[model samples]
Target: MDYTATLNSMGQGLCYALVSILFIFLAKKLDDWRTKNFDDDRHIDDGNLAVGLRRAGLYLGIAIGMIGALSGESAGFRTDMLYLLVDGVLITGCLFFSRFINDFVMMGNMNNDRECVKVFILGDGRTVTGNTALGTVEAGMYIATGFILNGSMSGSGGSFVQSLGSALLFFVLGQFVLLGFGLVYEMITPFNLRDEIKQNNPAAGIALAGILIALGIILKASLSGPFTGWVNDIVGFFVYTLFGMILLIGFNALVDRFLLPTTNIATEIKEDKNVAAMVLVQATIIAVALIIAHAI
Candidate 1:
């Protein structure tokens, strides 16, 4: 064992850690412009530590993903550092653009806005306003997006220009598939997602979060296949994404009937604000995702 090589590698790891932390700080700033209803200052002022911590988790996830993508190919220190910065910036930009599309184009502010605290009208006609699960959902989405895109971009060894093109293509196609899934979810559900979330329904938020993560898992699996042409790869991703959606829907239907026979998840979430039920719903979604991820 060469001590010199070992020490050098340790130093490099420390440097990467420092730079990754910096990138996380910068990524959070970049995401700030697109994030809605997640006012950091307000949350902090109101002593809502959960919201603040979730935001950190989201940004850190993005940074870590970018760092992982930028690493693994041996190169000079300066060149690697430059690539890391560029990868972080580009990935962050892609995420921000996706959020813009989801918020402005897809949601259209019709879902009653994505605020942390929402007013819920109970069955007894009582209006209760308080913090909701959107914060957790938002954080989950960012982390899931990072996981998907990072996994897609990894190991596609190429020049900066080639890598950038692939990243852009994957990002656009992935967002498109995700939007389609959202529409399908809306169609199958009994109530409007936006309205439910606006009513401070954490159950809705959890379900959506689970779907996003599941899709990300699906996308990662689809993209990790053999390197084919751009057209073939994109088309293949769409097909796999659809299959994943079907699997998710089917699993949910079965669970709704069999897993907890007495509990109607949707009603419990919408009318009862059953946080435990919501957590179970999320767990089911993620469990399916993990199973698919492993199978793929």
Candidate 2:
């Protein structure tokens, strides 16, 4: 065995161990803060805020480390490190900003008595299951992977328009995959899948699948041309849908189980005619943000 190789491996192991310890310490601190200000009604928002702060801090630290490493490394290391730093900063910033916006919107909705939560298309009030979150994450992972591949496959001096179109096509394909998996899971589950779809019944799932697949094909077509265009209209739809569903169900459950049926403003808004309109507006904003993100 090469002594130099062994020493290098030990150094890398120490670096990872230190990073892990720092993460653990940060998690412990955040947990303590949450316990100190624990209010059942506002737990989700508080937790989100804590997570956002921690993520921002972690990313910033990582970015700084990358920059430092790049400053003292070979050209190849410098190039790779710079990419890592930029990507880290972008991801962390997006996450923190999104969480902040979501929290603000949630609070505003509560104050205005609007219903922002719907678990499924059927408007069933169920908390978001782990399966749903995993599905969404998996879709996101695939979309990102596709984007990286698109960039790599684009030959030297590739058009930005072509690259962007390719990324969007991949993203829509990822969404279709997610919906397909969800449909399959629904069919295999013990519960009636028909009850899960909105007004259209089980056929609704089939309809949605068809629509997404068609959109994916359209995106693929758009990428074929030079001008570059997006085929998918419903960007970040799944994430927001899951979030709204989980949040609404969890909040309603808390109120029903713990608080008395007080004639409060928030409760009144839940039943108001304007609640659905508010949800539509929120959904539109989310869609726009997602589109802009992809474009950038």
Candidate 3:
């Protein structure tokens, strides 16, 4: 390799190491926080440790698989497959280390005198807090993966360091984008479908389905051509599809609860009008945000 290429590879490796260290530290801190505040069960339980490790492994495998696919050269399908296998194993190994540390901290801090707290694993408006430590770990992995993928594309020669840095940047950017989309969706289309289900509102369900379909269409459109090509160039199309699905579900729930009400015709009509306006506003915001981000 040329001098510049050598330097680029070295830099990428360093970046990967730094990214790994950062995530490991984050996982450890999260574990500490969880043990101090959340896990009241005094005795260290293997079950929680196992669960956390499994979750980490699963996410790591996914990230690696994704990266491998994205890194494939067109010359040989076999080469692509090998790349996926190797990278997936490497990434998964790193994830395992992070999980091990997380588990140690959590289990070590368990106190026998305290009762274990039940935490919410999913959903909004939940009373109990979920495993924030695990969440942080997962998020860290995603960020790391995004950084690595982007770095590789930027002529960094797929060095671990460069990829990790690029993945981290993408993770931050993705979070902001998701947050903006979420808030805009909420403000424009607030409806409670849970309440509707309790009251058996057929129209509410229909409205929810419609909203989901519309959002799906918009996502498909946004991912067309150059935008999709660029995203695929880095993280691959699968990740984008997965992300789009997540957003779809979240948006659907918001519409069901906030936009559609199980009430009189007059109220429903009023709500529908609001929902239409909200949909327009959300669509516009999402389009604008995507355009701006892509341009940048």
Give me the candidate number with maximum lDDT: 1
Q: Model 1 off-target regions past 4 Å?
A: 30-39, 49-57, 110-114, 117-133
True lDDT of residue 70, candidate 2 = 24
Spell out the clash pairs found in candidate 1: none
TM-score of 3: 0.30
lDDT of 2 at 49: 29
Q: Model 1, range 1-296, lDDT digits (tens) per residue?
A: 99999999888777777776777777667555544546665755776533563565467557746755665566877777777777777777766665556555445453313354445566689764443555555555666677667766675555667666776788777777777787787788887876775555667777776777777877777776544667777788878887888998888788777766887767876677777776787688787888897798
Order of candidate numbers by TM-score, starting with the best: 1, 3, 2
In TM-score terms, candidate 1 sits at 0.84
What TM-score fits each model?
A: 0.84, 0.26, 0.30
Give per-residue lDDT, candidate 3, residue 44: 29
lDDT of each prediction vs. the true structure? 0.68, 0.33, 0.39
lDDT tens string, model 2, 49-163?
A: 2223323333333333222222222335345444434433333333233223322331222211111121323256544311222122222222222222222222222343443
Model 1, residue 1: displacement in angstroms? 2.4
Q: For residues 1-296, what per-residue lDDT tens digits would candidate 3 score against the true structure?
A: 49997896677545544444444455445445645754423322534432343345334434432443344233344553444444444444444443343233322332211212333432345443233223322333333333333323233244444444444444344334433433343345446443332232333323332333233233323322232233454464335535554655565455445544543322452344243443443454344434432542
Top TM-score model: 1
True-structure RMSD for candidate 1: 3.4
In terms of lDDT, model 3 sits at: 0.39
Q: Which residue segments of model 2 deviate by more than 4 Å?
A: 13-83, 97-296
